[model samples]
Target: MSRVKTAGALNKYLHLPLVLTAVFILINAGVYLLNTRAGILVSGGLVIYIILILVIYGRQRENMLNDLVTFATQYGQVQRKLMMDLALPYAITDDRGKLLWFNDAFAELTGKDRKSFRKSIASIFNGMSPDKFPARDQEIEYETVYNRRDYRIQIKSVVLDDLIDNSQILERDDQEESSMLYAFLLFDETELNNYIQKYEDETMVCGMIYMDNYDEAMESVDEVRRSLLTALVDRKINKYFQDLDGIVKKFDKDKYLIAMRTRTLNELKGLRFNILDDVKTVNIGNDMAVTLSIGIGANNGSYNRNFECARMAIDLALGRGGDQVVLRDGDSITYFGGKSQAVEKSTRVKARVKAHALQEFIEASEKVVIMGHKMMDIDAFGSAIGIYRASRTLNKRAYIVVDSPTITTKPFIDEFENNPDYDSKMLLDVHEAKEMVDDKTLLVVVDTNKPDYTECEELLHRTGTIVVLDHHRQGNNYIRNAVLSYIEPYASSACEMVAEILQYFAEGVKLKSIEADALYAGIMIDTDNFMSKTGVRTFEACAYLRRGGADVTRVRKMFRENVDDYRAKGETLSNAEMYRDHFIISVCPSGNLESPTIVGSQAANQLLNIKGVKASFVLTEYKNVIYISARAIDEVNVQIIMERMGGGGHLNMAGAQLPKVSVEEAVRRLKRVLDATIEGGDLE
Candidate 1:
């Protein structure tokens, strides 16, 4: 290649010298051919002209060569000086990832002296070398060895044939082959990141603090000490925010608004917002403890936006039973502490008020349609029946929407179906109900507030006037357009809430024997036969039902398990295994069982009897959908665990459904979720 390139250069510049030589030869030959004095004289003059032309051309060529040499020398010196004096950390690497050369800044940044720089770039830079460059330039953040500071790195490709080290590579090669090289330039970004972190630390975060059960707490104290108790609560709250440099103001009787810096807020988060525990320790002579519901909003667009988020968060915290901290960053929410059970309200004034409003709505509607969640359990069905009775009490036509009932609810439904006084047309299937619904019909949703979980979501959409009555905590997807919503997370069950509402009905309006028994059964099943979540109002509602002639014996017989279901439960318990030290997990074997979910719940309850177990989970697959029943005994919040898997229930007992997964896969996913909850400090 070098010889061919030399011949081409000679051919390009040979024209000037060859033309001069040819002209001289032609003049000499013409003079000799003339053979005369005149021709000889002319030839002599041409010789001088040729000599002058040759000398001028030679001098011009020499000067051009000298100028080229000078420019090359100067360019080489300037390039060398730039490499040595450049402020940015710079380095060059060959195709093999070996470091060919580096500037002083790079050596200093990497904490390597010239003597110690004889290593590969990857080895020196902690293995960040790129084998090939991307088509476009890329900027990356790198950490240096000097002080572990961050650097913004830029790399560009430098072909060997065009690089300053081309001669060195060519000299070392026997069969010359051009290779690829890279030029790296790095700028320190440590200070920039520090500035960003400082801004984050100083950012303002908004929050709201609610004194849950404030009126009840104050009422429990002596009349003379009530002011003192309020002062004490204020002192605790003020002192809590004193060190945080936060501004706190009491906006209402039970609510306080606060503004705090994100640095202190993060510290509070790390400590799990111990204010909830701290306030509980304050003693004002009240038998019941006072708790707090704190909601924080961070990383939002504006202060007002964050404040709005905080307000929504506090509502959610209180709806989920209070004694918790909820942090809302835009659409995502993270919960901190919610260990205490909800305190049942001391008065039913709200229930009475809501009942009156519902009566007014029902009085104006043409007809009423009541519905519950799918797989209607006793609490769901009983709540539906209670609402239906309430509509009848108002002297309006009503219907109960029922679909494929589960085994647990089949007997209770059968009693109603067999009753003579009950209207056979009152029970409507989802399809018929959808057809019957109109703009004037009142849709009262019971047991569950989520539209997705309703028996007839299509009918729900068609109905104009709707009322929501539920005991579960308000979730993200609640029915938003209800004219009236009565959701009390503190209630024992939906039936218990509806039963309370039934008491406030007009005079001479009453519950039938079967309706009373069904409502009582709903209360019993949800409270685990009054063994869990039963409050004062729970028993009061049951007493009212008994007064209405609710036969306990009949309700008990309705809950009796058939032989096949009993066998399924026993088989499920046989496969129980302990996990996470003390929690039991059992996957029910696939079979044509009548009620797999009932068996799963029964099996979960029985697993709690094991000596050291604190929680139990039963997995059962029916028609390719894996159903899980999670139960805990004062040691875990299985509700949150199930909520993470798209299900929700009470704190100690919850269930989840996993679609299109086998029993083994469901168990594996359950374990992984348990692991994450435990690792994330939400569970023990």
Candidate 2:
């Protein structure tokens, strides 16, 4: 087929030259046939014509060759463009891995133009070597950056063996090949990976809700009553979620699953779920209240992980005795509710065990230094003093660290200051406290176990020998390095723990009247004069204090506030607002005269006075910090709510500090978390 085409092309060329020659010959013959003079002129004209024909034939051949070159150039350009349009970065390289050709897409993907690309592929790719690349039909995936854009690139190499073989077909077997060629295809996956990462992040927040006491709520009810209850729950839920965008589905008769976008989560954070107090008031035939337990998972990096976290939070709420809201974010867990009643627990064994452990810890240290939470109250002061007395009995040098100016209990501070035996030199500031702390120094943390709330966080960290005694519910931040930990949430106050430990050490030895009074004052302050949250152990501890010469009248006098302070407390209580059936919220801006502790407690107590109120919370400003106090009347769990704000206490009472946040901002954040708890949403 090739030979036939070549012959035809050659024949066409020969025909053109032959026609020119024939025309010239014919002109010369005509000139000879004419007269002599005319013949000579005609001959010269024929010769000129021959020269013209030859020149034209040569020009035609040159044009054909130019056209062929032009066609080849256009064809190569079209092939390069076609490869680029295929969505892959394409490049041509010689056997030595040197780039010989590349299209616009290749340059764009590599952030290098054709000139730079030809110089060296490794110039753009750091640490890349030609020898490391795989052969034809094999591909490798690697990460690279181009023009500040991160990408996962796929590199492939191909050998032009067929082209090379054809070119060298006539060459000797021993002849060395001059060059080899390879084609590379690079695909950008940066945007795709980013999209996948976004999806993973969104999926991780999960929400869960469980119906507390479902069986109890349904007991004694017929099928018709059960259906009515279910319908009512569904209607309330649908209505509550009308404004929020999320998928709400009934997982079971007593469970629900909800999926929401992150934007929806942020929006839901503002709705105080405490407003759903009416949900617990669902009236059936027996007038029984039905409450829901909600768990929200936050901090999961993926949707499935968040879902699992939400499930775990719900389980924790149920395990701790339901009818509450549980939120777990990372390592921290917060709870709300459990105020209606506390599950009865016996702590006799725990107390005895803790007592033995405390003795062992005391024996191990060179000396014991007792401290309390910042802004020391009577409970903190009493607890520290009790621990100091215990250390004295052991013949160990002891110190009670206190910042008196920051003390909330002015009378208690003054009384300690006036004591003849009190050593002023031993009282250390945070920096001096660090110098005093050592491996041999037994640092006993009283009243609170939270590091941020401690009077001396540096002392806690510096001392290897440590002990913690508190009455607050266990939180994630509870001291972990304590040689001994005696935490009893059921106890009324830290003073109770100190008194109990002192009894174990003294064995009926009488406490001084002042010491006894200070201890009694702590119990009274925490228990609201034994009107709320007084358990059997609390009263027993109080009775012991009374026997030890605690003057009831004197203790009452210590609690008496100045007329201005009293008026401030009364004003704060007057601002309380009742929301839902169970909760009351009040904002108390007590100015400079009122301590946050005083204002928060005053508002909490006043909220309890309202008819049908089960729980009360107060937001108060003191200095630059916003303080929060939560109180409940055996029907609400206030500790969990306070814990969410980085505070922990008993089921009935808890307090927290919000640094650098305005009282209004703290209240707004608190309401959002409360709303999610009351309602149901993803926790993680």
Candidate 3:
């Protein structure tokens, strides 16, 4: 193909001029017709002129072509010499990344001689893989550290046929057909990366620090030492930030603004924000230790946006209960120092404020749809009832959304089924709720804040206004767009939080005996009959329910288990295995029980009473999902362990659901998580 193309090019450039000259002789015949003597003289002169010109031109053309070939040869030699000893690091590899050839620069840098050069790029470059290479039309670049210098390698894929037509060095010997080859050119980017790293280290990280229990800690100490306690805390915080090359500005008595370089933030992260514990231990004869919540925002592209993210992160840390560090980097959020339980708020002023906000939302809305988590438990049902009661009080149409009510919630659901006082449309299914929602409707989510966990997640997007009321620790999968979000991890139950909100919903908010009973049942069930997580506010909510004609005896009788449930709980307990002499694990039998997951939770709670058990986990298979109920005392933090499996709750009580896995696989995963937790020293 090359020879044909070369011959055609020569014909166009060297033969066409001779053919034109012959056509000129035929035109001279017309001159001969006019004057024979003159035409003969002209023709003779023209023939002589053409002969001399062709002889001279032909000789020069030969010399010109030879000189051109000679120049091309030297040009090719110079190019070959330049590529062989080029200063830039360059190498050739086959499509599978096996080294074919390399320049002196690349050979010297890689210390690869011809004898030992038959290796893949992966062996030469620390992390290169064959699959990481680009295709024939595409180019790829990657960074690696060679020796002590950072190198940027740019790989260009070439078809062998494209190069062989142009250069002898690229000719193939072994391969019968054209194939792809990669040419690698490496640049020393050590100095550039050093500058980039310096800039990154200098990048500002904006954050906010808030004293989680300023008033409570102060009140716990003597009045005279309160000033000293305040001074000590301030000094501790200032010194801590200063040591990290940070600046702290006191915005309020309990709040501070902090600015630090990214390097400082990294140092703090490596320390796991130890200042959280250090600040708590700074007790100047105070009965209650003070805790701190830190929120940091980095890599948000601007200082103001970072500060805004910091504010949002701080709010999240507080919402999940304080005494933690939340790092917000754009859309990603991370938590550390959440080992301690959230401190319960002593003041009801915030509840009153939220209640007032709820009143405004309800009054402005045309209707309200109350929803709860799937497999609705007593706490979920009671919180829905509480919101339903509040909505009805404001003369707005209200409906409770329930999907496939579970056994634990059936009895309470039955209490409202035949009641003539309640409207027939008060209880709505998921499909009905989706149809009922509109721009004028208010969506109130109770017990669970995650949209997926809700009975009708579609309703959240359907309604313009959403109100989230939850007592569990806010997971990463939370309702981000809500008009009012009140997540109190410290509260015993969603019912307790709603009870407080109801107190301030109106001046004279009256609760029906059934409504009071439902609310009472939620708190009772969540707190395990007021034995776990019962703070002053928990009891206060229960007392208010009592005032509203909630009978403790009636609530217990309503939730009492049947014979099968009791037997299942006993079996779970008897089958429990002690892990590491502290943790207990067991499986609960469904045994025709409608709510086997709840039975697992009860079994987990029962396991904590064992002599050396610090935490308990009970697994139950129901509806193709393996539900794990986790319980722990102050000795261990179970929430973090459960979060690994995509669940979250309070420090003592948490649960997770593993879908599309066998019971044996779920148990193996649980054991792995437990082992990882133990190795990580989280339980300590």
Candidate 4:
């Protein structure tokens, strides 16, 4: 092929031009000879000179062609020898990816000889096409098909200089019309990748294990039996980590720090941290079972940073109601094994201590600003009022921030706003609250602990000293850097928790009828009129409010709905559908209700009265946002289901909202979660 192409090029470039020059010289010589004898002699000399030049040009062209052919033949042999002698696997392919040649290493890598290298290199490797190959010089990592081995590949397109040690080829190799060849050098990376994976699997990880109900469990048994119960619990944990070669040390009476490798941690994640159930079986004559909250930090920073991460993880686990494992990787968090409910503690020591600490913060601040969540419900509003009364007892100027009140709580707020006996100046909007907040001001967040869910996130940011008091399950995005945090998932409502705090406030401080009534109504509404989530402490708080002149008859009248609202409630309930025999799901269409959240909760509460119903879900669409209210009986945990959708509450009742989705879509999503929960044996 090279000889044919060289001959044609030589004929076109050298032979044709020589023939034209010879014809012109002969014409000139003929004219000179016919015109004059002296001119004829001059033309003859010119013809001889021209013929000499032509002879030299032809000889030079022929010699150059012979050198090109010899170089092309030698270049092929040199390239072949170089490819064959390379230590790493190497292959050469044509412009179409057809394998032209391969070295012994490549043949050994593929378990084939040179004779079998007829297919495209990609076909033997991993079906790679020519277009996928690097057009310029590059190094890439890939895995082969035949032996499934990894390799670091270097590919370079063959250029003129590449053909013969800096010698330029006649045609441009970069042009599409030119036939180009690519060379590939593959270095085995399978062993290196295996070592890297083994290092990651053996990386050190730190974890903190907390006994969420340790105090309660220890109190349940006698002093003589307490040591025995502790030994049993310790044995269970030690035995679980024995095979992993984990190091566990008790940091406190109820806390432990564990060090283990990532491989063991992954195995524990696969088991869903079954040690929780194992420890629960160690009964110490307690009515409530023991549980643990574990925090794990993996692939984070160094050892110290991982330990700090573990501490934060355990705090999140406890905030989310204990009996769970929380894994932290930088800003990301994952939860597992939160099936059990948080056990209620019999003691109020923590509450009293928090109340005293809150009082000190209030007394030290120049002014106080109280706020609750957006679309403030009774529990949120009522809790704010309770804190307001506490602030008044300290003789400090305080303000309550409410941007817009919900329909259910608007009546109580209006009554408070009209009463001159109370300080009407205390009621303020978000703008006024932001202006009032300063470095010395204390911002007390009530009902909701999440910064995004507060009445005014800007106001929360303006104040230096802040406090968070909430009863909902601690979500992943709780407010950070609070002066005090009093989150009690075991409490029935934030109102109930606040009411308990109010009893331990400054001596002789009492709540008037209207203030007491608001707090009482908050408890009544959240507890479904004391029909659910009522414990001994829940009733005790209610009794304290009644003793302070809370009028239940008037509070009941406050919750009474008008004819239109009652009809909307009926319409929402009428759409209820059953799934898996005991689960109820419903969606309230848009434009049918002014207070979709309230009606949805009412409908969900109503669904529980039906026979054989284990859980209920009511979805309401208002202002392009779908609000879901979930309620469950003893056998089901609606909080876990709601948390999966980024909402939360207690185990029996929870709520979530989906923005920019239709009611039908929300219902479909809710049903899919319910199906998975049932399929996984998480719900009945």
Model 2 collision count? 21
Off by over 4 Å in 4: 1-61, 73-188, 678-684
Q: Pick the candidate with the highest lDDT.
A: 3
What's the CA error at residue 410 for candidate 3, in Å? Answer: 0.5
TM-score (all chains, Cα) for each model = 0.80, 0.57, 0.92, 0.81
Candidate order by lDDT, decreasing, is: 3, 4, 1, 2
lDDT of 3: 0.89
User: Candidate 1: where is the Cα deviation over 4 Å?
Assistant: 1-85, 90-103, 113-146, 153-185, 363-369, 392-401, 416-442, 456-466, 475-483, 505-509, 672-681
Candidate 4, residue 37: the lDDT equals 76
Candidate 3, residues 1-684, lDDT tens digits: the string is 112222567657776657767776776787798899978987997798789778977577767667767888999999978998899998889988899888889889988895567899898787788888987678999989989899999999887775676786666665475578999999999999889999999999999999998988988999999999999999999999999999999989999999999999999988989899899889779989999999899999999999999998898899888889889987899988788888988998889999999999999999999989988998999988988989888899999998878777898888899899899889988888889999999999999988888887778888779999999888678999999998888999999999999998877479999999999999998998788888999999999989988988888889888899999999999999887778899999986988999899999998988998889999999989999999988888899889887888889999998999988898889889889978876655
lDDT of 1 by residue, 1-684 (tens): 112222367557745666866787787777777777867787777778778877886577656656666887999999988987899988887666677788888887777774556677777666665644433333334455436777766776665455535565444353666556767788888889889999998989999999988888988888898888878888899888977788899988778999999898888888889889888888868877789999889888888899889988898888788988989977778877776777899799988998888889999999999999987888989988988998898888999889867888889888888888888889889888988899999999999878988998887779779999998876667788899988888898998998888888664349898899889989998887887788899999999999988999998988898888888788888878889788899977657677778778878888888889988999888877888899887888888888888887767878888899877788888999999988887764
Which candidate do you rate higher for lDDT, 1 or 2? 1
Residue-by-residue lDDT tens digits, candidate 4, 1-684: 234445466557756656766787767777776777766776777778777877887577667767878998999999878878888988888877888888898888877678765778777766578777765544444555346767767776774344443545543445455346788788788889889989988888999999988887877788898888888888888778876778888878888889999889888978878898888898868655779999999888688888899988998889878998999977889888777667777899988999999999999998899999988899999999999999989999888998878878999999988888888788889888878999999999999888888889988678779999998888788889799999988888899999999988886359988888999989998889888878899999989999988998999888888777788778877878888898988876546456768878988999899999999999887777889999987879998789878788888989898999977788888888888877876663
Better of 1 and 4 by lDDT: 4
Model 2 Cα lDDT, one tens digit per residue, 1-684? 112222367667657767867876776777778777887887787778778777886677666656766887999999867976766677777666678878777776666767754665677666556776666657776687767666565666664555556784644344664334556666667788788767654553567877765665676467678889877876676556555766677879988887766655556655645524557656667345677777778776666777888987875565444566677766767555555543223345556567667777776788878888887888888877777767776767788777643324777777767788676654566666777778888899998877777897888778778888887656556677777767655577889877777777735335778888888888888878788667777777888888988999988877776766677677777877767556788887666564656756766876787888877888878778888888877666666667666776766777788889987798788887677656743221
What total of clashing residue pairs does each candidate reach?
0, 21, 0, 0
